[model samples]
Target chain A: MKKKLVLYLLFPISFVACDNPAPEKKTEKIHLEKVNSNTDILAENPEIKLVGSRGFSYDFNDERFMQFYDLPVKNLHISIVDDQQHIQRLAMDLPKDKEAVNTLKTQLNKAYGQPGEDAGNDFSAFEEGDVLVWKGKDRLIAMITSKDFATAAKIEKAPKIDILFVKPEETNN
Target chain B: MNKLYTGALLGLAIAASSCGSKKIKIESINNRQQLDSVIALLPKTQVKVDSIPVRVLYMHLKGDFTFYGQPVKEFSIQTKDEQLQACTFDIEKGASDVLQQLENENGTGFKEYSNPILSWSTLPKKIQFSVQDFDGDLLTLSNKEKAAISLYFNNPVNNRITNIYKEIPPVTTTNDYQLEVDNSECGYRLYVNDFLVIDHAGARTLGVTADINPYLVKGKQQKVTVELLPGNDYDGNPRNRLHLESVVHVALKKSSKRSMFSSVVFDFRTPNADSMVREDAHSSRYIRASKFYGQLSAKVDHPFETDAVPYELPCYAAAVTDIRTIPDAKEKILAHYRKLQQAYLEKDSLQLEKLLYPLEKNLQTAWYWSKPIDGQTRWTNIMDKAREARDVKLEENVVLYTTPDGHFAKLLPAVYNKNPAFYLSKEDGFYPLDYYVNIDKNGDVQFAID
Candidate 1:
């Protein structure tokens, strides 16, 4: 009779535990009061500076990459440019920290609304690979966390999160 | 009955939870919709391409080029240069350091060790050497022949690492030869006919195979040699080899053109399990070297001979004007690279293809590849990789490697010799992009295939 009681009591606890895996501990803290305008990204972040310039057309191999000033990210740069040298896209890589990525995602959701489904198998500098996408009236965003299976299978590298932003017109093609 | 029912329910619940949690991640971005409340305030602006000051250059080549491995028909962008360098380019310096260290330890300069005698063995003919018949496992060898096997190293404290060789009955073949070695425990060097074919002294590997036809002569006597060396510490002292275990097997194989398999001509392996003691495995403490000879056939007739014939590549004899003599060559090269970089950023595969065409052809020719290359598809793949590649490093100062006659020049990083000036980092690896080109009389860049 006691064994039956104990087994019955254990069932609910196990079910609850399996159903609700504990929420991840926060690795970073970010507060987003409002959505950031692409035009204001440079003005708001005074430390952000233009690294160099390329011709008007976008080229991945040119001097158009910008350096993020002391950001906690690795390999953070902006590649896209307009004729006026305004940054059209920004790319930055975060260490494979799920909590941090989730935190940022939560902040983006709170500011910009819920993220949309992934769009296509398009080539992304920081935008490529397994990603979560969010679309705006004039902008497109992606959060890449992993590469293709074939490439990832051969290498045992930590997952990287790349956040990218581009103009909606450029993405239409 | 109640407990069994509960247990079964728990199992099902756990299984369901695991499967639910293992949801497949997204593969590519394909769908998205604009949120009603989200702010998007960029003014629509038309982009004008002609207003941009980027200049495009044409690619040309004028030289008899010597390809490294094979040949190709079209232009292709490549990531590595060493693979295309000719066979004569000595890319790896293996085993030389350890041998020099041994020479230094002996307080004497390096000298060739005495070769073991190849006197007539009393063992009857047709009794071949096998793993079971060696010192650890040899079956047909008489006590006299077993005694003749020199399988031990001298004491490392007193004696330097010496070369231990065994004479295999010479065999000739009309096919390409491959040297295969499996060394799990220690560093080793394998030789064919006294020619250093493999010097594997870095990280230990289970097996490695290399083309040995370049080292072997047809219709001539061939020999296989193995030299084992102790690893060194950061301070150059011989590393402790206590409790280490090693098994080495070296073989020469003849590959056929029509078939997928190759036959082993001769092979040498370590002693059997019974003979390997804990102390015997220690190279720092062992006082004797292990030696054994294979009873391989003196001659084996290969069924196919057409594979033996070498393919001769067409070498360019005439050379064009040197790129350095061209006016503002460096500036043009830098401009050309920047334009290419922009092409990548813009995802303009057509422009990228135009710039990379000559180099792709040269690479194809150098590699002896005859398949038709799809430039659009190749560039698309490159662009996709570039999209994912992060932490890009670029430099203005580039080192130019020109042809002997200065007809063409390729660019690499000035400080780093291995890769090009621009490389994209992913994890700990890098993707280097480099180009070789010639400047025409019209002051335009001609992509070179030579």
Candidate 2:
């Protein structure tokens, strides 16, 4: 009887568990969907694909991001995530002079403060015609590519991809 | 075991959260304090930010009075912005308050109050006060009154008092030599014939003397008039502020004529001996001698024969002799011809004429050459023709005659030889001798015979 009782209890418990169907592990899929959607949005707007950070994917149509790109900036990008989040994507369109790339790096450092230990070590040279990618915030991504790097060996050899995570103003405190 | 482990993990998580929250709270308070201190240091004069008491003292004294028997009350304190802040006092509240406080502290007579004292001092981080004693009495008020007296502290901390004293200029006169009457603290207007010469403005304390040269013309007296246009009486009392004790009447005499001639003789001595010799020989001796001889001879005979007489003859005889009837007439004629030769040699007529007679034919020839040709031949034809002929000359005997020294007569050939066109007009007279003689309408000779 006890065995039957145990079996019955186990059967109902299993049935209940089966009925629930182990909440589909949608975390990775949800994050993937968010990244895909953001990528689509970014692709639609050239300015967004140019400024993506590591783990965090951003909406290309954000008004603040648009305002930032509209500013008189050269080799400019939005780094949504940094080395802290492990995913890094750099997007940039640089001017002809290597000095311009250096200047952009310096400005980024000053604006975002120094890169922390998690930020993917130091910036590396961008491959020929390859868009640079960097890590930024959680699920935030950064990408940079420069048209000027094509002909400029020095600039193309070591193009600076500034990766930064920008937190929402409300979240900064 | 799993439950216990989960519970312990949760507890640790809670403790960590609390620690983080506490640290954030403490950090926030520290930041707030630092920000407050920074705001305080900033230069903020806005009334809302800070309020400081500003005490202004005003003293109104009746008439000019003496403080401690010394002439005072004229002194005024002017703010840096030229605002009149304070003046002397009669029944001064601020002075009385300070004096009473001092007296109460130091019983009765305060030795330092002998003189009418005006002094100021600042309390450390507290207040600044100024004291003025009218009766030279310091100890008069009680301690309670002293403490209650509203002391004027340095509000702006940069307040500066510029003492302004009355500036009474001496009496002045107008350019037209008239007395200038200025009876107002404000300056006067100086005018000549009612035309404004100078607009003296904002001159206080009256009677400012000015030395001005208006360039008035001599012999004519200008009516210099001055109208006293009063300035703004800053004291609010205009009565007796500007007193014209007397209008000074001064006459400016016209500058005397300056002499052109220098009292000291200027040395014009020629540096070159050669130049000196040339001027002395050519200008002084020969020219003067030739002039003398020509005048003397012109008085006696016709132009043609006057020069035939020898230069060695007595002065009167050489001047009066008739060469037409002279003894040794042939010799004189030869001598006259030789003079022409000598003229060519010396290049001087004055010298030649003194030694020989003037050739009548030569004079006639010169006279004919002096006439102007037709229009087409005016310049080139006449002058060119005259220059080519050696003997061709002007009919002016004064020009033709030479001195015995051969110096002065040298200039004549140069004149006639230069441009015949100039002398070849009817407008030019025939006898060049007429130029030398100072003959008036009466025909009386005024030649220098000596």
Evaluated with TM-score, which candidate comes out highest? 1
lDDT (Cα, tens digit) per residue for candidate 1, span B1-450: 445445534543454366453211111000110100000111122111122122321111111111111121111111111111000111012222322222232222211111211111111111111111233211122333211111111111110101000111212322556667876444555655444445554434655987655334333455566655443323334434511434456666654322222455666565424243354454434322233212210111112222332322111221245676776777777788777677666656567566665445433333323322222233435656566665555577776656445666656566433345766666768776554566655656755542
Q: In candidate 2 chain B, what residue range of length 10 has the lowest lDDT sum?
A: B158-167
Query: Would you give me the overall lDDT of model 2?
Result: 0.27
Top lDDT prediction, candidate number = 1
Q: Candidate 2 versus the native: TM-score?
A: 0.13
lDDT of 1 by residue, A45-148 (tens): 32222233322212111111222222234333444343333444545544344555567678667655886656554325334456666665555666665565
Instruction: Judge the docking of candidate 2 as incorrect, acceptable, medium or high.
Output: incorrect
Question: Chain A only: TM-score of every candidate?
Answer: 0.47, 0.28
B106 Cα displacement, candidate 1 (Å): 67
Q: B1-450, model 2: which lDDT tens digit per residue?
A: 333333333433344354442111100111112222222222343112122234432322222322222222222221222222222223233445444333333222212222333232222011122333322122333222211122222211111110000111112211112222333233344544333334443434343333222212222343445444333344633322333211112122211011101111111110112211245544632211111111111111101111111112112222232332334433433333344444434445344233222222122121222221211122222223333334423323212232222111111232222232112222233212211111123322222110
| Poorest stretch of ten by lDDT in candidate 1 chain B | B29-38
